[model samples]
Target: MLITIENRNYGSFKYKNSTAYVHYRNSVVAEVPIEGELVPARGKINMTTSVDLKAETMISNPNFMADVTSGSLNMTSTASLHGKVSLLKIFKFPATAFSMCNISFFILTKSIDSKCTSKIKL
Candidate 1:
């Protein structure tokens, strides 16, 4: 499966070395170092990047659904399922405050992977 994540005003978090991992079935499939994090209010991180996730190997069952095992983003840990909006919330970011962050989600069955690019603004 393939997934994409992105948003606006995503260059304002105070993380010098940001790292994130996306896992499925208790196995880490993708890992990336986001340059920075985005914070709207107090201690909230914003995920405003076009992160594309694809499955490396294809399963025999074409209707197989991916189960997100765990994900560590910007030092925060979470357990989010595939195709769930709460996955974004697991980052400890307030969805109500940064509504204009422009987060988009896309999924395509092919490879199991994820992509994240951090843009920090000081």
Candidate 2:
């Protein structure tokens, strides 16, 4: 599945070294690591990435497949800010940041049969 995350924060704060996860019944099915600045003040950053699912893992957990097919899979993310200061390009300040954010959302799948029709009849 293709996962896209957009940061809509309108502040000086930025998200760095971020990671997103796909969860099924509280277990992580996939993990995607993201690096770079995400969304600026009054601006937007769209990051598109993907994760691969193991067939063995899915087969072992029948409920995971059921949730995916039913479009009930959930996604979550956690990230911290890049807090570093430099002065005159000669001196650097230590980062003293201890903050993070967690966000969650659900993935929904739509049936194509409701939108399009098959021309070839079997």
Clashing pairs in 2: none
Best by the lDDT measure: 2
Off by over 4 Å in 2: 1-9, 62-122
Against the reference, the lDDT scores of all candidates come to 0.32, 0.43
Poorly placed runs, candidate 1 (over 4 Å) = 1-13, 37-45, 57-122
RMSD of 2: 13.2
Question: What is the per-residue lDDT of model 1 for residues 1-122, given as tens digits with 9 covering 90 to 100?
Answer: 22223434432222233445554434444454444333432244434433344356222223333322122211111221112122234443222211111121233323323333433222
Local lDDT at 103 for model 1: 22
> In TM-score terms, which candidate is top?
2
Q: Report the lDDT tens digits of candidate 2 across residue range 1-122.
A: 33333333333233357555544445666666666553434455566666674446545776867766666544333333354334344554433223222332334533221111111111
Q: Give all TM-scores, in the order shown.
A: 0.30, 0.48
For model 2, what is the alpha-carbon lDDT of residue 83? 40
Minimum summed lDDT over a 10-residue window in model 2 is located at 113-122
